[model samples]
Target: MKFKNLLLSWKYPSILLLGIGISNFGAWVYFIALNLIVLDLTNSALAVAGLYIVKPIAALFTNVWAGSVIDRINKRNLMVALDLFRAVFIALLPLTSSIWVIYSVVFVINMAGAMFGTTSRSYITKLIPIEQRKRFNSLRSLIDSGAFLVGPAIAGILFLIGTPILAIYINAVALFLSGIITLFMPNLEKDRSLEQSDSSLSWKIIKQDWAIVLNFSRQYSYIMFMHFLFSCMMVMATAIDSQEAAFAKAVLFLTDTDYGFLVSIAGAGIIVGALVNTMIVSKIQISFLIGLGSLFVSVGYIIYSFSSSFSIAALGFFIIAFSLAFANTGYQTFYQNNIPVEIMGRVGSVFGLLEACLIIITTTIVGVSAQFISIQFVVITGSIIMFALTILLFILSMKPSKSRYYSVKSVEAKDL
Candidate 1:
């Protein structure tokens, strides 16, 4: 009876994680296949690089107004629609020969992806109970870590047996299956009114939503500051990561095979860390997870920045990748527990837009700086900056007075 009751409680969350896992695995397959396809067609590494640019560009275009629509819609149905939308577009990708056409399709797909991200976060927050959030998030992180390794291996197998185009179709199928699975989950807002309808989406309404997010930030200043600092840490990580290939080649003198092995080490670390995190998450405080996890991730980057050999770099990669699961799980729980479901969409989108902008700016700066200066110097500088930010995050997270922010009880959002 106890076992049955536990199974019943986890049924929906388990199903949701399954759908998320499928989608995440498919996304990785699509990413590798798309990069290969572009490289094969254009034979230009820069052309392949453009594929990375499309996602942030898409976010910039979509995120400004996506929240207004996400907050007012049926999140489950919208999630389903977005999955099908991406599936259709992904299915069509193999038929297109022009790189420009592929880019255009990918851009559209990414826009839908941005909206799906916010909608799913809000939906998950609504569906999961407060007390269960941390465990659920830890499980989700474990699934994501599994996907990180499995997705690439599956893509490689598909490439060996078939073409990259075949992998693309497989991803389309995966998205369709994910949509079907999502259909089985109950809708939390089935009877709730859409107070902020899509029909009211406009400059004025978007401005109001911005104001609402700003007002929330003011009321919950510490929370938003933590969010901002976390974003800064991620931005610096991105900037430093942009130089990874160059640093590996120029500084460490690593061959392609060596770099591949290094990545595999990181994958191993992720799986091991996630397994441990899952088993021990209930015993650890959410604040410590966010604080220590983030601080260690930066420490790992600092290690990598100063490494002279492949083994040292691999250790750095392992540490950062391992810490990622904890930091991600902690932040997800914190965001869901604190942000009211009513305004979560807007808050996520607004903050997402800021993060995207920072990514672009920071990446460009890092890239240009590497061209002019040593990649090692640029990477180390960025990592040091990240370390500083995480230290501040760690200090703030340990404050006894601020422990309320990480509590299991949800905080109410102020009215706009």
Candidate 2:
């Protein structure tokens, strides 16, 4: 009876989780499969690298205006539409042999993805109550970790049986299924009324939204700082990660097989940590999860930065991956709790634009510096900067006066 009641309470959230898991699993499969297809078509490593650039480029173009649309529409319907849109584009990917056409299609798909990301964050905040967000995020983390491991394995099996094209079709099917699953979730905006006189987007409206976000930041400086600091940490992480293959080969003297094994170890770490996180999330403070978890993640990078062997690098991977679940869950819950749902889309998109720009700049600098200097030196410098940023975040998170931000108590969005 207790189990039945619990399941009934979580019916919608559970359904949403299923959709997210399916899409996430499909995403990984599509990523690996597409990379292989591109490599096979072009036979150039640089061409394979171009696929990675398409998403951020799409983000740079889309995020500027995505939040405006996301905030105005019915989120559930938009998500379903976006999923189907992506599915169609992904299905079309196999037919195109030209690299430019493929990049164009992928760019459109990523633009939909970026809008979907901001829409879902705002939608989740509205659909889930404040009290349940941490638990939901933890479970979501576990599902993401599972996909991280299983998705690639599934793609590999598909390759053995068929081809990369087959894997692409499978992802299309998964996304279609995800969209269908999302149709069952309740629409949060069914009873809500839009307060605007003109709903159509324009340069003026976007500028207004930007001003609103800036005003919110001014009013809630601490909250915005947390967001900015976390983004900087992620940018640094991405910069360091761009040189990971070079670091493994040049500094650690790891072969391809060893590097693959090390990645699996990190996946294992994520699963283990997420499992533990799901079990104990209710007992731990959100501040600790964000501050300490992130700090430990940086420590893991620091360990990897200084390591000279494959085993040591593997250890660093495990530690960082393990800590990521807690950090992500904590920050997600905190953001949902503290940010008013009304402006969440605008805030997320504007900040996301900055984060994307920083990633491009930081990654370019790291890559260029590694070419000029040493990979280890660039990686070590990036990691140390990340570590310092996290320490500041830790100190900020621990302030007694700011404890209200981390509380799990229910508060209305209007009150925020």
Candidate 3:
């Protein structure tokens, strides 16, 4: 479907897309300012790194039972509440000069973010039809990439005009605006029957919800395995990302402006890829979309790991970012289509918890390994691991996935 046609077909989806885009802008701006604050406060690279870990740590705890709460509540309300919650905390951030208080506020905001993510996905799955998910996801990818690209540039301008504190205040205002926009979207409350039957919103239900998710997992091993592989991809990507600036400057001898140009090209690549996907996604099989995109991204990173020239490295960045749009859209479509709609919140929270923990664990291992091993060797290993995993997933896609709820063959036959 054409992008214009897609937008015209839905009212709430467009609103949601615009809201999320704005939210992402706020998030990226806040992230940049927060990292700067940490570095300025402690004058320690380790402390800044420590601050990065705070989100994952908070997710590890919040995601354990977030599904329980998400399933029982109004998703729209939850999203708005989370946005307002985050806005309040973020607005309060500049009031304190204490590094510890900043950390505490950041952690709370991150927790709200984690819950928002799982709940929003569940809400989207319910609101958007299965056939249109690929398109919606592609649009989301486009907005997210565009937001990341624009947000930092805007933040930098704010810093130039005033201070990083000004950027934080701007983000808080953005969050507030996002919340107000969300209030205008379609009011999609859960089915009254489902909500009535669902367990009450309480901590005691967390254990029960987890058991439900575990049983659900056993019934759908293929889905869980794919999720695990995706987790690995995420971890490897994070590991490579952590060392990206260092490799770009220290190893490739690129100047700061050169690295900035490379990043801009990568962002442009993502937008281009998403644009292309919107045009071609309806004709492509999702398994091919995912498997081939994964292969493409892995190959790009492998090229990056070995490249000695700026031009070649820039090509790697383009390839990775471009294919990443496809991979992300494919995975999101797969996730939304296969999972039972009612249990989406619970299963998603479980997956989030697992992915968040794995990311931290893998990143820590890579960081420590870099201390003794050659950084180049560590990076190459991550690239190879990504390649191997993608290759395995591609091989597995030779036949239809074992998922009872959705199949690659069904995806092809339905033309969705």
Q: 86-189 in candidate 2: lDDT tens per residue? A: 99999999999999999999999999999899999999998997888999999999999999999999999999999999999999999999999999999788
Where in model 2 is the C-alpha error above 4 Å? 191-198, 409-416
RMSD (Cα, Å) for all candidates, in order, is: 1.5, 1.8, 3.7
Q: Which ten residues in a row have the lowest lDDT in candidate 3?
A: 407-416
Candidate 3 deviant stretches above 4 angstroms? 1-8, 190-198, 201-204, 401-416
Residue-level error in angstroms, candidate 3, position 17: 0.5
Listed per model in order, the count of residue pairs whose N, CA or C atoms clash below 3 Å is: 0, 0, 0
In the range 1-416, model 3's lDDT, one tens digit per residue, is 69988667787888999899999998888889988977888898888888889989999989887888787778887888889999999999999989889889889988998999998898898788777788888889889888878899898998899888889999999999899998897677745332453556766778888888887778767767776787688779998898888788777988999999988889888888888887888888778777788889999999999989988988999999899988888888888877776778888888888888888888888888877786778888999999999888666644554434335322221221
Q: For each candidate, what TM-score against the reference?
A: 0.98, 0.97, 0.92
* TM-score rank order: 1, 2, 3
Backbone-clash count (model 3):
0
* Candidate 2 worst ten-residue window by lDDT: 190-199
